[model samples]
Target: MLSPNLLAWSVELFIKEPGSNKTVFWHQDITYWGMGETDDEVTAWIALSDVSVKAGCMRFIPGSHKGGIVDHEDTFSADNLLSRGQEIGGIDESQAVHSPLKPGEMSLHHGRCFHASGANRSDDRRIGLAIRYVTPEVCDQAPGRDWAMPLRGEAPAGGWSCIAGPRGLFHAADLALYDSIIEGQTATLAAGAEQDVSMYGGTKA
Candidate 1:
Protein backbone atom coordinates (compact mmCIF):
# COMPACT_ATOMS: atom_id res chain seq x y z
CA MET A 1 0.00 0.00 0.00
CA LEU A 2 1.19 3.53 -0.73
CA SER A 3 1.09 5.80 2.27
CA PRO A 4 3.50 8.70 2.29
CA ASN A 5 5.47 8.36 -0.90
CA LEU A 6 4.08 6.27 -3.73
CA LEU A 7 1.03 8.44 -4.30
CA ALA A 8 0.97 7.98 -8.06
CA TRP A 9 -0.83 10.55 -10.18
CA SER A 10 -0.83 11.25 -13.90
CA VAL A 11 -1.50 14.57 -15.61
CA GLU A 12 -2.96 12.96 -18.77
CA LEU A 13 -2.13 12.32 -22.38
CA PHE A 14 -1.89 16.06 -23.17
CA ILE A 15 -4.85 15.29 -25.43
CA LYS A 16 -5.40 16.47 -28.94
CA GLU A 17 -8.95 17.84 -29.22
CA PRO A 18 -8.86 18.57 -32.94
CA GLY A 19 -12.48 17.48 -33.48
CA SER A 20 -15.04 14.84 -32.73
CA ASN A 21 -14.78 11.18 -33.81
CA LYS A 22 -11.25 11.16 -32.41
CA THR A 23 -11.31 8.41 -29.82
CA VAL A 24 -9.36 8.06 -26.56
CA PHE A 25 -9.35 4.36 -27.18
CA TRP A 26 -10.06 1.72 -24.52
CA HIS A 27 -7.68 0.53 -21.79
CA GLN A 28 -7.70 -0.36 -18.10
CA ASP A 29 -5.40 0.91 -15.33
CA ILE A 30 -4.83 -2.48 -13.78
CA THR A 31 -1.07 -2.29 -13.96
CA TYR A 32 -0.89 0.42 -11.30
CA TRP A 33 -2.35 -1.25 -8.22
CA GLY A 34 -0.83 -4.62 -8.73
CA MET A 35 -2.52 -6.90 -11.27
CA GLY A 36 -5.17 -9.06 -9.56
CA GLU A 37 -4.93 -9.01 -5.76
CA THR A 38 -4.22 -5.31 -5.32
CA ASP A 39 -6.32 -3.93 -2.47
CA ASP A 40 -7.65 -0.77 -0.84
CA GLU A 41 -7.11 1.54 -3.77
CA VAL A 42 -8.92 4.83 -4.37
CA THR A 43 -8.64 7.29 -7.22
CA ALA A 44 -9.68 10.86 -7.92
CA TRP A 45 -10.15 11.99 -11.53
CA ILE A 46 -10.18 15.75 -11.98
CA ALA A 47 -11.09 17.71 -15.05
CA LEU A 48 -9.16 20.95 -15.37
CA SER A 49 -11.97 22.65 -17.28
CA ASP A 50 -15.72 22.66 -17.72
CA VAL A 51 -15.68 19.25 -19.33
CA SER A 52 -18.63 18.10 -21.39
CA VAL A 53 -19.49 15.26 -23.75
CA LYS A 54 -18.36 17.29 -26.73
CA ALA A 55 -15.19 18.44 -24.98
CA GLY A 56 -14.07 14.89 -24.22
CA CYS A 57 -15.09 14.75 -20.58
CA MET A 58 -14.71 11.46 -18.80
CA ARG A 59 -17.34 8.73 -19.21
CA PHE A 60 -17.87 6.07 -16.61
CA ILE A 61 -20.28 3.18 -16.56
CA PRO A 62 -22.36 4.05 -13.50
CA GLY A 63 -21.57 1.63 -10.69
CA SER A 64 -18.94 -0.07 -12.82
CA HIS A 65 -16.61 0.09 -9.87
CA LYS A 66 -18.51 -2.74 -8.25
CA GLY A 67 -17.92 -5.09 -11.15
CA GLY A 68 -14.17 -5.11 -10.62
CA ILE A 69 -11.73 -4.62 -13.49
CA VAL A 70 -12.61 -6.07 -16.86
CA ASP A 71 -9.98 -6.98 -19.40
CA HIS A 72 -9.44 -4.25 -22.00
CA GLU A 73 -7.65 -3.67 -25.28
CA ASP A 74 -5.59 -0.66 -26.15
CA THR A 75 -7.90 1.77 -27.93
CA PHE A 76 -5.37 4.58 -28.21
CA SER A 77 -1.90 3.72 -29.34
CA ALA A 78 -0.44 7.02 -28.27
CA ASP A 79 -0.25 5.89 -24.65
CA ASN A 80 -0.51 2.17 -25.16
CA LEU A 81 2.23 -0.34 -24.41
CA LEU A 82 1.52 -2.07 -27.68
CA SER A 83 0.89 -0.70 -31.17
CA ARG A 84 -2.43 0.95 -32.03
CA GLY A 85 -5.48 -1.22 -32.82
CA GLN A 86 -4.09 -4.00 -30.69
CA GLU A 87 -7.33 -5.65 -29.55
CA ILE A 88 -6.67 -6.21 -25.85
CA GLY A 89 -8.97 -9.04 -24.78
CA GLY A 90 -10.07 -8.13 -21.26
CA ILE A 91 -11.78 -4.71 -20.88
CA ASP A 92 -15.48 -4.84 -20.03
CA GLU A 93 -16.53 -2.42 -22.77
CA SER A 94 -20.22 -3.25 -22.59
CA GLN A 95 -20.41 -1.93 -19.04
CA ALA A 96 -18.15 1.15 -19.35
CA VAL A 97 -19.36 4.45 -17.96
CA HIS A 98 -19.29 7.35 -20.38
CA SER A 99 -19.33 9.59 -17.33
CA PRO A 100 -18.66 13.28 -17.93
CA LEU A 101 -16.84 15.61 -15.52
CA LYS A 102 -16.83 19.29 -14.62
CA PRO A 103 -14.00 21.65 -14.06
CA GLY A 104 -12.89 21.87 -10.41
CA GLU A 105 -15.13 18.92 -9.66
CA MET A 106 -13.78 15.38 -9.59
CA SER A 107 -14.92 11.79 -9.52
CA LEU A 108 -13.61 9.43 -6.85
CA HIS A 109 -13.85 5.73 -7.49
CA HIS A 110 -12.27 2.38 -6.91
CA GLY A 111 -9.13 1.70 -8.85
CA ARG A 112 -10.93 -0.96 -10.84
CA CYS A 113 -13.78 1.25 -12.02
CA PHE A 114 -14.67 0.73 -15.69
CA HIS A 115 -14.11 4.11 -17.30
CA ALA A 116 -12.66 5.82 -20.39
CA SER A 117 -12.64 9.07 -22.34
CA GLY A 118 -13.56 10.10 -25.89
CA ALA A 119 -12.35 12.44 -28.61
CA ASN A 120 -12.95 16.12 -28.00
CA ARG A 121 -14.84 18.01 -30.67
CA SER A 122 -15.03 21.29 -28.83
CA ASP A 123 -12.37 23.95 -29.35
CA ASP A 124 -10.74 23.41 -25.96
CA ARG A 125 -8.16 21.21 -24.39
CA ARG A 126 -9.59 18.14 -22.68
CA ILE A 127 -7.11 17.90 -19.88
CA GLY A 128 -7.46 15.68 -16.84
CA LEU A 129 -5.44 14.81 -13.74
CA ALA A 130 -5.80 11.48 -12.07
CA ILE A 131 -4.53 10.74 -8.57
CA ARG A 132 -4.45 7.39 -6.89
CA TYR A 133 -4.11 6.32 -3.24
CA VAL A 134 -3.10 3.05 -1.71
CA THR A 135 -2.88 1.85 1.84
CA PRO A 136 0.55 0.89 3.26
CA GLU A 137 -0.09 -2.77 2.72
CA VAL A 138 0.34 -3.35 -1.02
CA CYS A 139 3.87 -3.46 -2.34
CA ASP A 140 4.64 -2.78 -5.97
CA GLN A 141 5.74 -5.85 -7.86
CA ALA A 142 7.51 -4.10 -10.72
CA PRO A 143 10.87 -2.60 -10.04
CA GLY A 144 14.15 -0.95 -11.21
CA ARG A 145 14.71 2.82 -11.65
CA ASP A 146 10.97 3.47 -12.10
CA TRP A 147 10.86 6.08 -9.31
CA ALA A 148 8.84 4.86 -6.32
CA MET A 149 8.26 6.69 -3.03
CA PRO A 150 7.81 5.50 0.53
CA LEU A 151 4.66 6.95 2.11
CA ARG A 152 5.22 6.25 5.78
CA GLY A 153 7.42 6.60 8.87
CA GLU A 154 8.71 9.65 10.70
CA ALA A 155 8.82 12.73 8.51
CA PRO A 156 8.56 16.46 8.90
CA ALA A 157 5.05 17.97 9.03
CA GLY A 158 5.67 19.72 5.72
CA GLY A 159 7.95 22.68 5.25
CA TRP A 160 9.84 23.10 1.98
CA SER A 161 9.61 19.38 1.58
CA CYS A 162 11.02 16.94 -0.93
CA ILE A 163 10.30 13.43 0.42
CA ALA A 164 13.78 11.91 0.62
CA GLY A 165 14.19 8.16 0.32
CA PRO A 166 15.78 5.28 -1.58
CA ARG A 167 13.93 5.74 -4.84
CA GLY A 168 10.76 6.34 -2.74
CA LEU A 169 9.14 3.06 -1.72
CA PHE A 170 7.04 1.82 1.18
CA HIS A 171 7.08 -1.62 2.76
CA ALA A 172 3.33 -1.90 2.25
CA ALA A 173 2.55 -3.60 5.60
CA ASP A 174 5.30 -1.77 7.44
CA LEU A 175 4.57 1.93 6.97
CA ALA A 176 2.63 3.46 9.82
CA LEU A 177 -0.85 4.89 9.37
CA TYR A 178 0.65 8.34 8.86
CA ASP A 179 -1.81 9.38 6.20
CA SER A 180 -4.86 8.22 8.15
CA ILE A 181 -3.72 9.95 11.33
CA ILE A 182 -2.22 13.08 9.79
CA GLU A 183 -5.68 14.44 8.99
CA GLY A 184 -5.06 17.97 7.64
CA GLN A 185 -1.35 17.45 7.55
CA THR A 186 -1.01 18.93 4.10
CA ALA A 187 -3.02 22.05 4.83
CA THR A 188 -1.38 22.56 8.18
CA LEU A 189 2.00 22.34 6.58
CA ALA A 190 1.33 24.74 3.75
CA ALA A 191 2.79 28.20 4.25
CA GLY A 192 -0.55 29.90 4.02
CA ALA A 193 -3.90 28.32 3.22
CA GLU A 194 -4.23 25.12 1.15
CA GLN A 195 -4.28 24.61 -2.59
CA ASP A 196 -6.93 21.86 -2.63
CA VAL A 197 -4.05 19.47 -3.14
CA SER A 198 -5.09 17.76 0.06
CA MET A 199 -6.48 15.15 -2.27
CA TYR A 200 -4.16 16.16 -5.06
CA GLY A 201 -5.40 19.71 -5.74
CA GLY A 202 -3.63 20.61 -2.46
CA THR A 203 -6.97 21.35 -0.77
CA LYS A 204 -9.85 19.25 0.38
CA ALA A 205 -12.82 18.99 -1.98
Candidate 2:
Protein backbone atom coordinates (compact mmCIF):
# COMPACT_ATOMS: atom_id res chain seq x y z
CA MET A 1 0.00 0.00 0.00
CA LEU A 2 2.98 2.35 -0.53
CA SER A 3 3.63 4.67 -3.43
CA PRO A 4 6.10 4.26 -6.27
CA ASN A 5 9.82 5.05 -5.91
CA LEU A 6 10.26 3.95 -2.29
CA LEU A 7 13.41 4.50 -0.28
CA ALA A 8 14.35 2.22 2.58
CA TRP A 9 14.75 3.88 5.95
CA SER A 10 16.57 0.86 7.26
CA VAL A 11 17.02 -2.86 6.74
CA GLU A 12 17.50 -4.78 9.98
CA LEU A 13 17.74 -8.46 10.78
CA PHE A 14 15.67 -9.80 13.66
CA ILE A 15 16.94 -13.03 15.13
CA LYS A 16 15.30 -15.00 17.92
CA GLU A 17 17.58 -17.68 19.18
CA PRO A 18 16.16 -21.09 20.02
CA GLY A 19 14.80 -21.25 23.58
CA SER A 20 15.37 -17.52 23.93
CA ASN A 21 13.05 -15.64 26.22
CA LYS A 22 13.35 -12.31 24.46
CA THR A 23 10.04 -10.85 23.38
CA VAL A 24 8.98 -7.95 21.17
CA PHE A 25 6.51 -5.98 23.19
CA TRP A 26 3.46 -4.44 21.51
CA HIS A 27 4.37 -1.11 19.98
CA GLN A 28 4.21 0.97 16.83
CA ASP A 29 7.10 1.32 14.41
CA ILE A 30 6.82 5.09 14.19
CA THR A 31 6.86 5.82 17.89
CA TYR A 32 10.61 6.27 18.29
CA TRP A 33 11.58 6.55 14.65
CA GLY A 34 11.97 10.36 14.94
CA MET A 35 9.37 10.61 12.24
CA GLY A 36 6.17 12.19 13.50
CA GLU A 37 2.85 10.47 13.30
CA THR A 38 2.22 9.50 9.68
CA ASP A 39 1.18 6.54 7.61
CA ASP A 40 3.93 7.12 5.06
CA GLU A 41 6.00 4.20 6.26
CA VAL A 42 5.73 0.42 6.04
CA THR A 43 7.87 -2.54 7.01
CA ALA A 44 8.37 -5.71 4.98
CA TRP A 45 9.34 -8.61 7.25
CA ILE A 46 10.78 -11.49 5.23
CA ALA A 47 11.18 -14.74 7.02
CA LEU A 48 14.59 -16.39 6.65
CA SER A 49 13.44 -19.50 8.49
CA ASP A 50 10.22 -21.05 9.68
CA VAL A 51 8.30 -18.74 12.02
CA SER A 52 5.57 -20.56 13.90
CA VAL A 53 3.80 -19.98 17.22
CA LYS A 54 6.46 -22.09 18.88
CA ALA A 55 9.09 -19.96 17.21
CA GLY A 56 7.63 -16.65 18.32
CA CYS A 57 5.89 -15.45 15.18
CA MET A 58 4.61 -11.91 15.16
CA ARG A 59 1.07 -11.19 16.33
CA PHE A 60 -0.84 -8.11 15.27
CA ILE A 61 -4.03 -6.53 16.51
CA PRO A 62 -6.49 -6.28 13.68
CA GLY A 63 -7.19 -2.72 12.50
CA SER A 64 -5.27 -1.26 15.44
CA HIS A 65 -3.59 1.27 13.22
CA LYS A 66 -6.90 3.00 12.75
CA GLY A 67 -6.51 4.38 16.26
CA GLY A 68 -3.21 6.01 15.35
CA ILE A 69 -0.21 6.18 17.68
CA VAL A 70 -0.72 5.22 21.27
CA ASP A 71 1.31 5.75 24.41
CA HIS A 72 3.96 3.11 25.15
CA GLU A 73 5.74 2.38 28.40
CA ASP A 74 9.40 1.57 28.08
CA THR A 75 10.44 -1.18 30.46
CA PHE A 76 13.98 -1.46 29.12
CA SER A 77 14.04 -5.06 30.16
CA ALA A 78 17.02 -7.12 29.05
CA ASP A 79 14.72 -9.83 27.77
CA ASN A 80 12.89 -7.49 25.42
CA LEU A 81 14.02 -7.46 21.82
CA LEU A 82 13.05 -3.84 21.30
CA SER A 83 15.63 -1.16 21.93
CA ARG A 84 13.35 0.51 24.45
CA GLY A 85 11.24 -2.44 25.48
CA GLN A 86 8.14 -0.43 24.63
CA GLU A 87 4.72 -1.85 25.38
CA ILE A 88 1.16 -0.63 24.98
CA GLY A 89 -0.90 -1.67 27.89
CA GLY A 90 -4.54 -2.79 28.10
CA ILE A 91 -4.44 -4.76 24.88
CA ASP A 92 -7.07 -7.48 24.43
CA GLU A 93 -5.10 -10.62 23.75
CA SER A 94 -8.22 -12.36 22.52
CA GLN A 95 -8.30 -10.15 19.43
CA ALA A 96 -4.72 -10.77 18.41
CA VAL A 97 -3.88 -12.48 15.12
CA HIS A 98 -0.73 -14.50 14.69
CA SER A 99 1.29 -14.20 11.48
CA PRO A 100 3.19 -17.36 10.74
CA LEU A 101 5.56 -17.47 7.79
CA LYS A 102 7.62 -20.12 6.12
CA PRO A 103 11.05 -19.69 4.62
CA GLY A 104 11.10 -16.96 1.90
CA GLU A 105 7.65 -15.77 2.91
CA MET A 106 6.93 -12.22 4.09
CA SER A 107 4.43 -9.90 5.70
CA LEU A 108 3.91 -6.14 5.37
CA HIS A 109 2.52 -3.89 8.04
CA HIS A 110 1.91 -0.21 8.50
CA GLY A 111 4.13 1.90 10.74
CA ARG A 112 1.34 2.53 13.20
CA CYS A 113 0.18 -1.03 13.57
CA PHE A 114 0.17 -2.62 17.03
CA HIS A 115 2.33 -5.73 16.69
CA ALA A 116 4.52 -7.88 18.88
CA SER A 117 6.10 -11.33 19.13
CA GLY A 118 6.44 -13.75 22.00
CA ALA A 119 9.44 -15.71 23.19
CA ASN A 120 10.74 -18.54 21.03
CA ARG A 121 10.27 -21.99 22.47
CA SER A 122 11.16 -24.01 19.42
CA ASP A 123 14.35 -25.90 18.75
CA ASP A 124 15.32 -23.83 15.72
CA ARG A 125 16.07 -20.13 15.43
CA ARG A 126 13.58 -17.62 14.06
CA ILE A 127 15.06 -15.05 11.74
CA GLY A 128 13.50 -12.31 9.64
CA LEU A 129 14.79 -9.40 7.62
CA ALA A 130 12.86 -6.23 8.25
CA ILE A 131 12.93 -3.55 5.59
CA ARG A 132 11.52 -0.23 6.71
CA TYR A 133 10.29 1.80 3.75
CA VAL A 134 9.34 5.45 3.76
CA THR A 135 7.84 7.75 1.20
CA PRO A 136 9.80 10.85 0.23
CA GLU A 137 7.17 12.96 1.96
CA VAL A 138 7.99 11.59 5.38
CA CYS A 139 10.63 13.64 7.19
CA ASP A 140 12.44 13.11 10.45
CA GLN A 141 11.16 15.42 13.14
CA ALA A 142 13.65 14.39 15.82
CA PRO A 143 17.18 15.75 16.01
CA GLY A 144 20.24 14.95 13.90
CA ARG A 145 20.34 13.60 10.30
CA ASP A 146 18.92 10.40 8.87
CA TRP A 147 19.96 8.11 6.02
CA ALA A 148 18.10 6.06 3.43
CA MET A 149 19.12 3.73 0.65
CA PRO A 150 17.50 4.40 -2.68
CA LEU A 151 15.72 1.26 -3.78
CA ARG A 152 13.23 1.92 -6.60
CA GLY A 153 12.72 5.61 -7.32
CA GLU A 154 14.10 9.11 -7.73
CA ALA A 155 16.49 10.23 -5.02
CA PRO A 156 15.12 12.43 -2.26
CA ALA A 157 16.19 16.08 -2.22
CA GLY A 158 16.58 16.41 1.54
CA GLY A 159 15.59 15.02 4.97
CA TRP A 160 17.52 11.83 4.08
CA SER A 161 20.87 11.19 2.52
CA CYS A 162 21.52 8.11 0.41
CA ILE A 163 23.74 5.53 2.09
CA ALA A 164 25.98 3.65 -0.27
CA GLY A 165 25.39 -0.03 -0.86
CA PRO A 166 28.03 -2.47 0.37
CA ARG A 167 30.87 -3.01 -2.08
CA GLY A 168 31.41 -6.44 -0.55
CA LEU A 169 30.16 -8.30 2.47
CA PHE A 170 32.20 -7.47 5.58
CA HIS A 171 34.30 -4.99 3.65
CA ALA A 172 36.20 -2.60 5.92
CA ALA A 173 34.70 0.52 4.35
CA ASP A 174 31.18 -0.89 4.58
CA LEU A 175 31.67 -1.79 8.22
CA ALA A 176 32.91 1.73 8.94
CA LEU A 177 29.81 3.18 7.30
CA TYR A 178 27.61 0.97 9.42
CA ASP A 179 29.37 2.18 12.55
CA SER A 180 28.77 5.77 11.54
CA ILE A 181 25.08 5.09 10.94
CA ILE A 182 24.62 3.45 14.34
CA GLU A 183 26.40 6.36 15.97
CA GLY A 184 24.15 8.93 14.37
CA GLN A 185 20.92 6.95 14.63
CA THR A 186 21.40 6.20 18.31
CA ALA A 187 20.68 9.81 19.16
CA THR A 188 17.38 9.83 17.33
CA LEU A 189 16.21 6.52 18.67
CA ALA A 190 17.28 7.19 22.21
CA ALA A 191 15.69 10.61 22.35
CA GLY A 192 13.38 10.93 25.34
CA ALA A 193 14.20 7.43 26.43
CA GLU A 194 14.69 7.29 30.21
CA GLN A 195 16.92 4.26 30.65
CA ASP A 196 20.45 3.47 29.62
CA VAL A 197 20.69 3.06 25.84
CA SER A 198 23.87 1.05 25.67
CA MET A 199 22.06 -1.49 23.52
CA TYR A 200 22.03 0.97 20.63
CA GLY A 201 25.78 1.38 20.75
CA GLY A 202 26.76 -1.89 19.15
CA THR A 203 27.94 -2.14 15.53
CA LYS A 204 26.34 -4.59 13.17
CA ALA A 205 28.27 -7.77 12.46
Candidate 3:
Protein backbone atom coordinates (compact mmCIF):
# COMPACT_ATOMS: atom_id res chain seq x y z
CA MET A 1 0.00 0.00 0.00
CA LEU A 2 1.24 3.51 -0.79
CA SER A 3 -0.16 5.10 2.34
CA PRO A 4 -3.23 4.76 4.53
CA ASN A 5 -3.92 8.46 4.27
CA LEU A 6 -3.18 8.77 0.58
CA LEU A 7 -5.60 8.49 -2.37
CA ALA A 8 -5.23 8.60 -6.09
CA TRP A 9 -5.25 12.12 -7.55
CA SER A 10 -4.50 12.54 -11.26
CA VAL A 11 -2.83 11.12 -14.31
CA GLU A 12 -0.87 12.73 -17.14
CA LEU A 13 0.43 11.60 -20.51
CA PHE A 14 3.71 12.68 -22.08
CA ILE A 15 4.90 12.28 -25.64
CA LYS A 16 8.28 13.12 -27.10
CA GLU A 17 8.85 12.96 -30.81
CA PRO A 18 12.06 11.64 -32.28
CA GLY A 19 14.98 14.07 -32.19
CA SER A 20 13.01 16.42 -29.99
CA ASN A 21 15.21 18.77 -28.04
CA LYS A 22 12.65 19.31 -25.31
CA THR A 23 13.87 18.37 -21.84
CA VAL A 24 12.35 18.05 -18.36
CA PHE A 25 14.58 20.04 -16.05
CA TRP A 26 15.69 18.75 -12.68
CA HIS A 27 12.92 19.44 -10.19
CA GLN A 28 10.59 18.04 -7.56
CA ASP A 29 6.97 17.17 -8.35
CA ILE A 30 5.69 18.55 -5.04
CA THR A 31 6.96 22.01 -5.96
CA TYR A 32 3.96 22.81 -8.16
CA TRP A 33 1.33 20.52 -6.65
CA GLY A 34 -1.33 21.93 -4.31
CA MET A 35 -1.26 19.01 -1.92
CA GLY A 36 -0.82 20.47 1.54
CA GLU A 37 1.10 19.26 4.61
CA THR A 38 1.81 15.67 3.64
CA ASP A 39 4.37 14.70 1.05
CA ASP A 40 3.11 11.13 0.97
CA GLU A 41 2.53 11.10 -2.77
CA VAL A 42 3.75 8.67 -5.36
CA THR A 43 3.87 8.74 -9.13
CA ALA A 44 3.82 5.69 -11.37
CA TRP A 45 5.62 6.31 -14.62
CA ILE A 46 4.60 3.76 -17.26
CA ALA A 47 6.35 3.68 -20.55
CA LEU A 48 4.35 3.05 -23.72
CA SER A 49 7.53 2.57 -25.75
CA ASP A 50 10.96 1.25 -24.94
CA VAL A 51 12.74 4.06 -23.12
CA SER A 52 16.50 4.19 -22.88
CA VAL A 53 19.00 6.83 -21.95
CA LYS A 54 19.25 7.76 -25.60
CA ALA A 55 15.47 8.16 -25.69
CA GLY A 56 15.52 10.44 -22.65
CA CYS A 57 14.51 8.13 -19.84
CA MET A 58 14.03 9.69 -16.41
CA ARG A 59 16.90 10.14 -14.00
CA PHE A 60 16.82 10.54 -10.25
CA ILE A 61 18.97 11.37 -7.29
CA PRO A 62 18.68 8.47 -4.86
CA GLY A 63 17.31 9.44 -1.45
CA SER A 64 16.56 12.94 -2.63
CA HIS A 65 13.06 12.91 -1.24
CA LYS A 66 14.44 13.14 2.28
CA GLY A 67 15.48 16.70 1.57
CA GLY A 68 11.91 17.87 1.07
CA ILE A 69 10.90 20.49 -1.52
CA VAL A 70 13.84 22.30 -3.09
CA ASP A 71 13.97 25.67 -4.74
CA HIS A 72 12.97 25.93 -8.41
CA GLU A 73 12.85 28.69 -10.99
CA ASP A 74 10.78 29.12 -14.11
CA THR A 75 12.96 28.95 -17.17
CA PHE A 76 9.94 29.37 -19.47
CA SER A 77 12.02 27.85 -22.22
CA ALA A 78 10.18 26.61 -25.28
CA ASP A 79 12.23 23.41 -25.20
CA ASN A 80 11.20 22.52 -21.66
CA LEU A 81 8.46 19.95 -21.03
CA LEU A 82 7.25 21.55 -17.79
CA SER A 83 4.36 24.00 -18.02
CA ARG A 84 6.39 26.90 -16.69
CA GLY A 85 9.68 25.27 -17.61
CA GLN A 86 10.66 25.25 -13.93
CA GLU A 87 14.14 23.98 -13.12
CA ILE A 88 15.91 23.32 -9.84
CA GLY A 89 19.19 25.10 -9.43
CA GLY A 90 22.46 23.56 -8.26
CA ILE A 91 21.56 19.93 -8.99
CA ASP A 92 24.60 17.65 -8.90
CA GLU A 93 24.10 15.67 -12.06
CA SER A 94 27.09 13.50 -11.24
CA GLN A 95 25.00 11.79 -8.55
CA ALA A 96 22.07 11.00 -10.83
CA VAL A 97 20.86 7.55 -11.77
CA HIS A 98 19.45 6.94 -15.24
CA SER A 99 16.26 4.87 -15.27
CA PRO A 100 15.58 3.01 -18.49
CA LEU A 101 12.37 1.08 -18.99
CA LYS A 102 10.88 -1.48 -21.37
CA PRO A 103 7.56 -0.87 -23.06
CA GLY A 104 5.54 -2.62 -20.34
CA GLU A 105 7.66 -1.67 -17.38
CA MET A 106 6.87 1.02 -14.86
CA SER A 107 8.83 2.92 -12.24
CA LEU A 108 7.60 4.50 -9.05
CA HIS A 109 8.96 7.60 -7.30
CA HIS A 110 7.98 9.79 -4.43
CA GLY A 111 6.51 13.21 -5.20
CA ARG A 112 9.39 14.98 -3.49
CA CYS A 113 12.06 13.07 -5.34
CA PHE A 114 14.42 15.10 -7.52
CA HIS A 115 14.16 13.86 -11.08
CA ALA A 116 14.39 14.93 -14.70
CA SER A 117 14.81 13.69 -18.27
CA GLY A 118 17.04 14.75 -21.13
CA ALA A 119 16.17 15.55 -24.73
CA ASN A 120 15.17 12.64 -26.94
CA ARG A 121 18.16 11.70 -29.02
CA SER A 122 16.78 8.46 -30.41
CA ASP A 123 15.11 7.83 -33.76
CA ASP A 124 11.71 6.75 -32.37
CA ARG A 125 9.06 8.46 -30.36
CA ARG A 126 8.92 8.06 -26.58
CA ILE A 127 5.67 8.07 -24.69
CA GLY A 128 4.98 7.78 -20.98
CA LEU A 129 1.96 7.80 -18.70
CA ALA A 130 2.36 9.30 -15.22
CA ILE A 131 -0.29 8.55 -12.63
CA ARG A 132 -0.14 10.56 -9.39
CA TYR A 133 -1.55 9.34 -6.08
CA VAL A 134 -1.80 11.43 -2.96
CA THR A 135 -3.08 11.15 0.57
CA PRO A 136 -6.63 12.36 1.10
CA GLU A 137 -5.43 14.00 4.28
CA VAL A 138 -3.48 16.36 2.10
CA CYS A 139 -5.39 19.55 1.36
CA ASP A 140 -5.16 21.82 -1.65
CA GLN A 141 -3.19 24.84 -0.53
CA ALA A 142 -4.19 26.96 -3.51
CA PRO A 143 -7.37 28.95 -3.35
CA GLY A 144 -10.54 27.39 -4.81
CA ARG A 145 -12.32 24.08 -4.36
CA ASP A 146 -10.78 20.76 -5.30
CA TRP A 147 -12.07 17.28 -6.18
CA ALA A 148 -10.68 13.77 -6.16
CA MET A 149 -11.76 10.23 -6.99
CA PRO A 150 -11.86 7.73 -4.15
CA LEU A 151 -10.09 4.54 -5.08
CA ARG A 152 -10.25 2.33 -1.96
CA GLY A 153 -10.66 2.10 1.81
CA GLU A 154 -12.71 4.55 3.84
CA ALA A 155 -12.93 7.87 2.05
CA PRO A 156 -11.83 10.95 3.96
CA ALA A 157 -13.87 14.11 4.29
CA GLY A 158 -12.96 17.71 3.34
CA GLY A 159 -10.31 19.05 0.90
CA TRP A 160 -11.64 17.23 -2.21
CA SER A 161 -15.22 16.66 -3.21
CA CYS A 162 -16.08 13.40 -4.94
CA ILE A 163 -17.30 13.40 -8.52
CA ALA A 164 -19.23 10.69 -10.32
CA GLY A 165 -18.02 9.01 -13.47
CA PRO A 166 -19.21 10.33 -16.80
CA ARG A 167 -22.00 8.37 -18.43
CA GLY A 168 -20.59 8.89 -21.91
CA LEU A 169 -17.95 10.74 -23.86
CA PHE A 170 -18.55 14.48 -24.11
CA HIS A 171 -21.68 14.13 -22.05
CA ALA A 172 -23.31 17.48 -21.40
CA ALA A 173 -23.26 17.16 -17.62
CA ASP A 174 -19.68 15.91 -17.61
CA LEU A 175 -18.51 18.70 -19.86
CA ALA A 176 -20.09 21.28 -17.61
CA LEU A 177 -18.36 19.85 -14.56
CA TYR A 178 -15.06 19.76 -16.40
CA ASP A 179 -15.41 23.34 -17.51
CA SER A 180 -16.17 24.50 -14.00
CA ILE A 181 -13.20 22.64 -12.60
CA ILE A 182 -10.88 24.04 -15.26
CA GLU A 183 -12.09 27.55 -14.58
CA GLY A 184 -11.50 27.15 -10.86
CA GLN A 185 -8.00 25.82 -11.48
CA THR A 186 -7.20 28.75 -13.72
CA ALA A 187 -8.29 31.23 -11.09
CA THR A 188 -6.37 29.50 -8.32
CA LEU A 189 -3.13 29.37 -10.28
CA ALA A 190 -3.45 32.91 -11.51
CA ALA A 191 -3.45 34.35 -8.01
CA GLY A 192 0.35 34.55 -8.20
CA ALA A 193 0.86 34.65 -4.45
CA GLU A 194 3.96 32.50 -4.44
CA GLN A 195 6.61 31.32 -6.84
CA ASP A 196 5.46 27.70 -6.77
CA VAL A 197 1.80 28.62 -7.11
CA SER A 198 2.54 31.05 -9.91
CA MET A 199 4.59 28.48 -11.76
CA TYR A 200 1.78 25.94 -11.73
CA GLY A 201 0.38 25.93 -15.25
CA GLY A 202 -0.21 22.62 -17.09
CA THR A 203 1.05 19.09 -16.89
CA LYS A 204 4.80 19.00 -16.41
CA ALA A 205 5.22 16.29 -19.03
TM-score of each: 0.55, 0.92, 0.87
lDDT of 3: 0.76
lDDT of 2 at 180: 79
**TM-score, cand. 1 vs. native:** 0.55
Q: Each candidate: what lDDT? A: 0.46, 0.83, 0.76
lDDT by residue (101-183, candidate 2, tens digit) is: 99999999998999999988999989889988998878887423888887877877778868768899799998988887877
Residues 1-205 of candidate 1 have per-residue lDDT tens digits of 3345343322233243446444544434443233244645567777787678887665665664565556543343433221232233555667665667777788776655555566677877666666655444444443221222335453322221223332336754324433432333333223132222232221211
Model 3 misplaced regions, further than 4 Å: 4-6, 142-144, 186-205
Give candidate 1 misplaced runs (Cα > 4 Å).
1-6, 9-14, 18-22, 31-35, 67-69, 74-97, 143-146, 150-205
Give the per-residue Cα lDDT of candidate 1 at 190: 30
Model 3, range 1-205, lDDT digits (tens) per residue? 7666556666677778889887889988877566642566788999999899999999999999888677788777777777667789998999999999999899999888899999889999888888888766677875238666677666767777766667799999889987777666545544443433323232333
